[model samples]
Target: IRDFPTLMTKARICDEDGKAKSSYYKAMNDKKGKGLDRGKPYENKGNGN
Candidate 1:
C-alpha cells in the first residue's frame, strides 16, 4: 500500500484526475529510460480508461 505522505504529495502535484492520467501515461510511454511495460489488462473498476 502507498503511504499517506506519498499520496498527499501526488495530490498536491496533480491537482486534477486528467493531470494524473497524463503523468501516468507519460511515464508508461517513456523509452530508453525507466519506462513501464504495457502489462496484462485488468478490470478498471473506476471511471475513465
Candidate 2:
C-alpha cells in the first residue's frame, strides 16, 4: 500500500520534462539511491567539468 504512492510519485518525477526534479536528486544524494551526482544534470556545460 505504501509503495503505491511512492511508485506514483516517482513516475511523475520522471514524466516532468523527461528529467528528475531537484528533490529527486536531493533524495538520491541523502540515500545514495537512484540519480546522478548533485548538480551534475544542471551544471554549466561550457566548462566541460
- Runs of candidate 1 with Cα error greater than 4 angstroms are 1-15, 31-49
Summed backbone clashes in each candidate are 0, 0
Summing lDDT over every window of 10 consecutive residues in candidate 1, give the lowest-scoring window.
Answer: 31-40
Candidate with the greatest lDDT versus the true structure: 1
**Candidate 2: clashing pairs of residues:** none
Error of 1 at 11 (Å): 15
Task: Write model 2 residue lDDT over 1-49, tens digit each, in one string.
Answer: 3689989988887788465576687777888744464565556878876
lDDT of 1 by residue, 2-32 (tens): 6999898787776788788988898778744
**Candidate 1 residue pairs in backbone clash:** none
lDDT of each: 0.72, 0.71
Taking all chains together, each candidate's TM-score versus the true structure is 0.32, 0.31
